[model samples]
Each structure stands twice: as C-alpha cells, then as structure tokens.
Target chain A: MSQAACIVGIGETDFCRKPGSGMSQLALQLRAATAAIQDAGLTPRVIDGIMPFPNLGRAEQFAANLGCENLRFAATIHTGGAAPVASLQAAATAVNAGMATHVLLPAGWNGYSGARVRQTVSQDVASIPGGAIARDYYLPFGFTAPPQWYSVMARRHMYEFGTTPEQLGTIAVTMRKHAQLNPKAVMHGRSMTLDDYLASPMLADPYRFFDCCLETDGAAAVVVTSAERARDLAAKPIQIMSGACGQPYPADEITNRKDFFRTGLSIAAPEAFGKAGIGPSDVDFAMIYDCFTFELLQQLEEAGFCKRGEGGHFVEGGRIELGGELPVNTHGGLLSEAHVLGMSHITEAVRQLRGEAEGRQVEGAEIGVVTGWGDFGDGSIAILRR
Target chain B: MSEYTKPLPELEGHTKDFYGFCKQGELHFQRCSACGTWRHVPRELCAECGSWDWEWARSSGRGEVYTWTVVGRALHPAFQQSCPYAPTVIELEEGVRLLSEVLDVAPEALEIGMPVEVVFEAVTDEITLPKFKRVAAS
Candidate 1:
C-alpha cells in the first residue's frame, strides 16, 4: 500500500490590503509557489502534479510558469473559498496513487487591487456561480453583495436560535485579538474591543462592518507528498489525516434550502471527522473559516464543536481566545488576516502542527482542524496531525 | 419615474418565463407534474424527481416573512440612492420562497412569520417586479 499523504512545505506572500506594482494575481501565486518548492527541498522540475484555484488561473499555466515539467495529475476545486482545503484531498489522492510524486497547490487573487466583488459590476453570467439566479431573483431586489446574501441566513438564525449581535461580536473581537500576535496580519496592532465591534457601521442587518473579512491582494501555497518521501524532505511533515468537501441542498441558491440552518459544513464535518476516526473534541486547535463573524460561529456549531444554536454562547467567556479551550484562527483569520481565499488558514494549520507559530502557537499542539466556507454555504474540512 | 436606476432582471432562457409572468401582473412557479414539487428561479428538471414535466402554476400571492435584512449601505451604484432598504425572503403559501422588497413597511416592524401578500410595480416597460406588503391583521 502507498504511504499516507503529508504536507512538507507551506509558503505565503505578504498579506496586504493593497499590492504595489508587479503584484498581479499570477505574480502573487508564483511567489508563494516558488517559496513552497524551495522549502520542500525540491526544485520546480520535480513537482509532478498541480491544483489551482478555479476562476483565478489554470493548472497548466501555473505549472509552466513555475518551471514544473512532466506534470501528471491536475485538477481545480471550484468550491469557492472551500477550494484550498478541498484541493488537499485531490493532492493527497494523486500522490498516494502513484500518479504523481509532488503536488503543488496555489490559491490567490487581487481582491483589492483588481476585480473586487463588492465594486465590480459582473456582466458575464457564466463567470459567477448561480449567476442567473443572482441576476433574476437577487440583484433585482438590491441584494448584490456577499453580506447581503448571507445576512438572510444570519437573520433567520437569530430568529430561531435567539442568537445575539454581542455573540457575533465576540468572534470579531477574538479574531482581532489573535491578529495582534502575528505581524503578517493586515489588522495587526489594530486593537478592537467588543464595544468597538458594536460601534462598527452596519453593512447588512445583523452584520456590522467588523463582521466581514478583509479584501486582500495576496497568495498562499502548499507542497504535498507521500509520507515515505517526506522523511527525506527538509521540513517536518504534517500528515494529511483526512479531508472532504460538501455542498448544501440546491448548493447555488440559499433562499430555497429546506432547512435554513443546515449548511455544507453540517454535511462535510461528519464525513471528515468519521474518516479521520476523530471528533471535534479531539482537535487541539481549529482554523475555522471566518469570512464573517456569524459564519465562524455557525461553522463551529455545524462542525460539531458545539450543538446547533449554541454557537452564540460557545464563543463567550474567552473559550475561543488564545489560551482558552480551543484556540481558533491562531494566525488571525480571513476576518483580521488577509483573505487569500482561506489558503492562509491552511498555512496557519501547518505552522501550528510544526510548532513554528511563534507567540501565537498553541503549546504542544499535535493535531488541528482547518475548515473552509465558500459561496452559498459550500464547505470543506481537513484534519492534520504533527 | 427617475429613470428606475436600480438593476433589472436579465430576461432570457429559463428566466424569461418567470419575468414574463411578472410582467403580466401575476406570480407563478414551476411545479413538477410528476411529484407536484414547486420550484423557483426556473430550471428544467424537478428537484425531488427526475421528471422534466412541469408547468408554470399561478400562485395565491400570499406568504409569511421567512427572513430579512436591512441594507444600511448599498453595494451597487444604482442602489446608492435607496440606502436603508429591507430585502426580504417571503415563503409563499405554495411553499416556495422568493426574494423581494417589502414595501411601505418599516425595517423594525419586519418579523419572522409575519403575514404578507405580493404587490406589483412596473419598473420599466419590459419588467414588473413582484414586491410584498404586510397583511393587516384580520
């Protein structure tokens, strides 16, 4: 049998709100990819597989730019923000099946410097997920942004579960607090109290400005190989225990879902935890996707860390803070960290497993979980162990 | 009419019929002939079954507020003038949800399970949107 897949190298470009000259999307991706290849103690020519983020670029283009020749396996995960974590499954499967020796996964975009979702007027329906639905049903009603689309679910959650704005504020405050320890975080040293969170301008009802993630122009990359080959690599290997991706019913549209509270994580978390022979309690730390404050809280409940509707209380009393029960988003998160489409969450997971997280490191952390929340409730989860 | 600066639905393919129905001052959804499952934002096949047999059935134009959000900032350029509007999801009596604006209702007065009924507005000669209003207690 082939050895289990392991992550040997991880690299990321500087997370920033704005990019200087020459920081195109592809440029950011190439910078991160080169760093990861070198960190793995290998050259570009040795990499035999590639997985690129959907709609950003193609695998062949990335392979050619990185000087990676003789590529065997190539695939792109189209699960939106969930693409990065979902790509791990494809990379691991390729390596263990002898289809490839080394697989490189890269995800990034010029969210700030280029086409921003909030600012850009999308004319091509083919480019966006559920474009027809959005154009026909949503945009006509002035619901044109992510915060507007997701706020309905958050509002329903508040109505059914009695979730509060303060509960959601706790997540924003905690993530900003965690960002304070990492200098790479875009919001590092920008202190925010719970009062500050409440004082932030409301973008969408039930979602204050602080509830949203940063629109960053950056990239992050990871190198995966079999466990046997990882023994010879320069960096310590963090085993890819298991990972999976899932979509909620009628994945593209959220308004018609039979159960409003159920999300893609509600389906994926069980399968991922089952495959790993572990549960939420076994996780030493987690990198739950923090695209929004309510989203992070919802993922926590859906991922089985807490029961449904209990997320509002689960985050209170500093339980998710650095020293608390389960330190979440130790390298900040999409909320305070740059939003490289959740790829930074995976890099942070690797850093935690390698005991290189510096001041924000969870001491003696041997196992961790990373999750991704994408367009319209799509979710992916990966469990890693040192 | 102030040029109706907001976005208008792209009436094409499966979506053309939906907008056509609205333009006629009526609301309808595709209901599967095989399983009787009503669906919206029109598609070809039934979600519950694999049947392609469906029809655009007229609705009673009544529903309850399932969920809502009050937009304090308009993300789109055309909607900048309409700041602080409420976009709502109305669960129609036919068991389908439609996203539309709730007219003449204060944002604070919107509540889950509040009864509402559909109303029409002709934004342009080509499109008539189906908006909603709170049903007075009777």
Candidate 2:
C-alpha cells in the first residue's frame, strides 16, 4: 500500500465516431498528452514518465517524440476497458516511489468506420500465463467477443433474478440522456428509445445493437503527481485518494467462474473503498465503466451500491439520473459517450472534478468513483475527490 | 422458421465434433476425474487440480436461466438476420453454466429461475450449438 498520488491534470481529443479526422493514433495521443501537461500548467520538458494504453502510441518512439528525455516510467497495459484505472494506478505508484515527478497516461484508437469497423483483438492479444486455460474449452463455443462473453452474465441475471430487456435498456437510455448534455459525447442528443432497442439487431442474443457500445476513434490522457505538490501547480487538484487492481482468482472467463451472481469487480470496489476510507454511499457521484449495459448493472451490484438482484429496481427508479441520489456517467459513458480505446471513464471523472462539464454536470459534485473495464478476469477501481 | 440460414462464427480448438452433443439437443459437462470438479470448455486436464484424467459426460442441461439480455439491434454482419434475439445463460443442473440461445420462447415468456431444457440447433454442418427452451408450465 503506497501513499496516494494526485491527478493534477487531464485532457482528451474530441470524442467522435466519424472517420477521416486525418489524425494518426500517435498524433491524437500526443494531442491529449500535451493538453494534459498544459492543463497541469507544467512544461512537457518536466514529464519524465509515460504509461500509454495498448495501441495508443508506439512505445519508446512516442516518448522520444514527446521530448521526454531519459524516460524512467514507461509501460503499456491491455485487457481492453480496464486500462484506464490500471494505468493510473501504475502512474500513482511511480509518483509515490519518486520514480518520476510528472506522469502521463494516454490512450488512442483510430478504427471506427474508416479502414475497418473495429478489431476485436489486437495483434498482441493473448491468453494469460497461468489461469487463462479455458481458451481450449470456450473459444470453440463462439464465446469470443468480450461483450458476447459478458452475455453469460446477462442471461444468468435474467434466470436468477428476472431481469428484463427493458431494465437493461434503462441503463443505456440514461447514459444517452446524460450524453445529450456533454458536447464531447458521441451519442449526445442522439436519443435511443426502448422500442428501438428491442427491435434492433443482435450480436450474441440478449444483446442488441443499442445494448452494446460504439467503436470510436479518439484519445485521452491524465497527469499525476504528489497531491501535496499538485497544490502548487496551476491546475486544480483532483485527489486520487484510493486505487487498486485485481482479477478473478485463477479462472479462464467469467462464465467458467464459480459465482455467476457476483463478479471479481465486487472484490475490487471494497479494497479501493477501504483505501479511500469511504463507502459506496458516501460518494456523491460515480463514473462506472459500461462496455455493455448489463455489466454496468452487474458491477453496481458487485460494488455494493445495491444488494444482489436489486439493481433492476434501483436503476428503474431513476437512481442513475443526473439529479438522482448519485448521478452515474455524468459525462455520458462508454454506452453513450465516445468509446475510446479505454480510460474514457477516467477522463470523465477528471471533467467532473474540474466542473468543466457543460450539460452533464452534477450540482456541487465533490466526490466520485471510477472503474476500469477488464475481461480476462482483470479489474481495477479508483476513488477521487475535489 | 425461415429457410434462409445465418453464418455462424468459426471457433478453433477441437478437431472433431467434441461439443456436438450440445448440437444434438443435449447438455454435456466435462469432469476432471483426478480433481472431482466440473469444467465448461471440454479439456484433457483438470483445470483446477491439473489432472489429465477427464471425460465428457451428459448433464441434465436443466437449470435456472441465470441472466439474459434482449439485444435491441443487430450488431454483426452475421447477426443482421437475427435481430432481437434473447441470448441467455443457463446454469445447468450440474452446477456449471454456459452461454446459450433461448429459442422457440417469446421474449415475454422469459423468467429468471424458470426451468429450461436443452435443445439441439444445427448452426452449421459440423457445428450444433446447445439452445434452451422454457419448460412448459402444467
């Protein structure tokens, strides 16, 4: 357990689902990184470390281009949606150990509609060393796509708790409603009805087009340093009070696990909460990862926001709205916002802390919890406050 | 049912129709004889105890439908013809759960904890996916 590292600055390329923006992934990542540095009011020359999400920048060359001389902190992480919080945790550890003064965590992707729709696997995507032994068993069954893999949960929830399609659509619609207020949200003002949801096409059954997220091309980055030193910087301090990364105990995929009702995410949320000395109810806002609609609900239940099987009712009561008990995905979300490579939720948390969010702003928001998207049994959590 | 067929995804691993029973309208679970635990992906070794002693056995394929989602729209080129289908997860009677399609049942008829049984669906010439149908209430 290391000391808390502060997130002093955050920046992002505009969120859009369009192609032919004429920006390579490297350039887009640089735009976000440089903006993060400037947002922290620090010179790029001061940054000595960088942790980019997979496919964003070309490793060492990216650092060289950023003019980071003698870069001491550098690495890349995969597991798709979980990269944001995990990379931030890496940066925080580096800051705590005095490995680097300023750290940059950037992510980018440029395949929405231009060259191809989107690739489900990276050239380097692989099975984990120890526990990922189920590729032989499940891959042959068409349980490949990460979202479709999550469909196991969706089905189980319906069987165990009577969860319905409309209940899942409620999550999507809520995220879209919030996106309508966020200028950077791709689906902003682009409303989707439940009928449109039910009538849409299916990917793996039980998951329709609207039930899944879009593939967008963009980038985002955040700056981290000592919370004490962050006060001296020109940017407002967004404290990274608690952070953690964990995975399912030696399992292949979610379906192969013992408990289908509770996921490993539940294992992560409490650890971050204990580190932050705050409970789920104490937080004023949440920036949960939503690669698929049912997962968000499943995560909510696992994170202790509500009891098991209670999420359907909790969300249906408008508890997830901007003016509700605790507004979730205020900057929209992966569901309605731009689905960058990863870390979109972290960037949204930064915006919420800075109070720069236009229409999706929660009134007087002072606390927030952000999560990472990891499948392959990996997950991470972060607790932040203004 | 329409005569038109939808192309299914090609999965690599087993050379023979190892999972063919699921397509033959039956649920099969793999048992690690050395460790005494059930596995989803048919394997040669015990995933938990690392024992190579294993065999594929028939399961009741009768369990509660744990969770499911009703996809609102078509997502893939292969799925365009099958919009608005209920992809379900059925927890088999053997304490193992598998992702499966709930067929011949209307969307409104789906209920959590409802009893279901396995049915064979020939997705491709060499592939048969195990689908589920709700047990009719007496």
Cα misplacement distance, residue A362 of candidate 1 (Å): 0.5
Model 2's CAPRI class?
acceptable
Candidate that would win on TM-score: 1
Q: Show pairs that collide, candidate 1.
A: none
Off by over 4 Å in 1: A18-22, A121-124
TM-score of each: 0.97, 0.82
Model 1 earns a TM-score of 0.97
- What is the TM-score, restricted to chain A, for candidate 2? 0.93
lDDT tens per residue, model 1, A312-368: 999999999888999999888999988889989999999999999999989899889
Worst 10 residues of 2 chain B by lDDT: B7-16
Question: How would you class the docking of model 1?
Answer: high
